[model samples]
Target: MPEKVNGIVADAIRRVRTSSGVPLAFAGVVTGPTTLRLQHFVGQHVGALSGLSVDVGHGLGGKVVALNRLLAVDDYLRTPQITHRYNTLIEREGLRAVMAAPVIVDRSPVAVIYGAMHTPTPIGGRMLDALASEARAVEQEIVAARARMEHAAEGENEMRDRMTAAFARLRDLAGTVDDARIAEELEAITRVLIAGEEPAEEPTVELTGREQDVLSLAALGYPNARIAETLGITVHTVKGYMKDAMRKLGASSRLEAVVTARRSGLLP
Candidate 1:
């Protein structure tokens, strides 16, 4: 997992543990294509869970990962919906009731967060909601982090392509030009390009808090009216913020602005 995702997961575990009144809250990030490794936790008696690997479709957490949804069991050891491969570990940890929510990104499970009770007590609806909310929050963070990385990779490729094109143009000009001094200058410019001098940086664009909020919602595929409803602002005000953000980003459309802002690390 990326550092950003790890940080978010850690914070989410703490928040879930406190807000949900769960004695144990732990997060397992996907360590392989079909495996989740318990990485972070809160609460005592969780030492046995450290570095535990939950395979997809095997344990309570694995069921969540396999199904990509929230799951709860009143008695984990007696749960029939999931396999009992991790029963030994669960028994060692003295956990009876368990709940798990999957952190999904792009419709795939990226991690699983679990909350458990030492006694066979059913988790409340509010606690379940809180755990699911934390999982969703982590999912959103992972999605944004992945988008930023992809955008950065695309930018690097674009820069390299532009540099290569410029170098070729300079070389072509140097070959066709008759003036030796101009040709030498062109060659010198090509040398500078080959040395990797970057182009002039674009002016930094700063968006206000509201502008950022609107754009972030837009990036998540929310319409202006929905964004307005979410932020408790008027649709007209949402449009205004979107317009301002688009102008600052030099984007010709809403999607363009969202892409640019995400690439610039202005949206999360």
Candidate 2:
């Protein structure tokens, strides 16, 4: 997990459990856009559950890992999932009821949050939700998945964590701002950051509206001509803005400008 995002997730999980009546306790992240590479379990008391992997077609989490669905086991050893990753941990914790919910983004499982109680009581369906709900504080894709609309941000759990934490502060800063404007900025920043390039460490400067427009499109991987068509501006004007941005960021390349912007937490 990115340092910034881990801070946010840790803070959020603590706040949610302390403030709410829900018994939800832990979460596990599966990172990647397509092939879900298992990260590790993140829980309230997670020191004991780290031996498992994001192994496909394996344990309970492995099953959720493979199927991208919610799973529950009343008795860890006897349950029909038929495999246990951390049996010693389960026994040590003395938990009887356990539930795992897939946190999806773009119709894929980016992470899973698990809740357990020390008794054999049934975990309510509503309660299973409280676990995953807190995860949304770190990544909107968690809550968004309940609505069942595929969100583009719902990719690797770690990247989503980094992206969300990096942007959440910016979003608050942009409070009450127009959605179109926000969308433009996100579109632009995404392009450069994900382009496998490093933006330079340039001094900060206020960008002109035209410059902002062009950078946003560029960040979203839009070509100069396509950006020109979308913004109803000339390709030459787009090139000019790119030049301005390069100078402002002291960047020699487009990727550098983007990296600097993202590291500064100004763009998504």
Candidate 3:
């Protein structure tokens, strides 16, 4: 289990215990391929379960983990639905009844949270529902955390691909240019681009309504003449708008201006 998940489960245990009025609430995380170790707990007077390892299908928790469902035994020591391997520990702690809820993530059981009573009181439906609700909350937290991590990883991969393409384009331009000074300048820009340094501060640039309309058409591969005809403007006026837009965007070419505008949310 992830360290973040461990903290989440721990907080879930505390929440469940407080909300349900359960005397003892504890949790075991799947620390191995087939075993869950008792990790976090509350209201424990005995240390018999301090380092207990519950294997799949071996105990009540194991059964819950293996079945991927909630399990409760009113008389835990005598329950036939599960094996009694941990009865000694339960007896040591003087627990008469217990319930286990599995925290599943991505269709796999990642942790098991348990609630118990020191007396021979059966866990009621309402209390069981509360425990299951906490487990569901933990499952949602895990799923959301995983989604954020995956989204960040995808963003990083996209940025790397873009940087690689930019570097390749700069290299190609450097090789094709005849002017030595221009080639050296392109080489220097390539080094800066590859270094991935943060720009000082971005200018807060906005495009006018007319400028946006022209750029949107230009992005669709419209020539200046076609844009002028579509917008009921002269070709010279279209060129003037594009030139001003490109200057504000700090783009040397029409394509770069369009890309910058879209990236900066200046154009759709």
Highest lDDT: which candidate? 3
Candidate 3, which ten residues in sequence have the lowest lDDT sum? 194-203
Instruction: Go through the candidates in order and give each one's C-alpha lDDT.
Output: 0.81, 0.58, 0.82
Scored by lDDT, model 3 comes in at 0.82
**TM match of model 1 to true structure:** 0.66
lDDT of 3 by residue, 94-181 (tens): 8888899999987899999989888777789988999999999999998888889899999975775565455545655676799999
**Prediction 3 TM-score vs. true:** 0.65
Better of 1 and 3 by lDDT: 3
Question: After superposing candidate 2, which stretches have Cα over 4 Å from the reference?
Answer: 1-12, 15-24, 32-46, 50-52, 132-268
* Better by TM-score, candidate 2 or 1: 1
Spell out the clash pairs found in candidate 2. 26-43, 27-42, 32-156, 188-216, 188-219, 191-219, 198-256, 199-256
Measured against the true structure, the TM-scores of the candidates, in listed sequence, are 0.66, 0.44, 0.65
* Cand. 2 Cα-lDDT: 0.58
Error of 1 at 241 (Å): 53
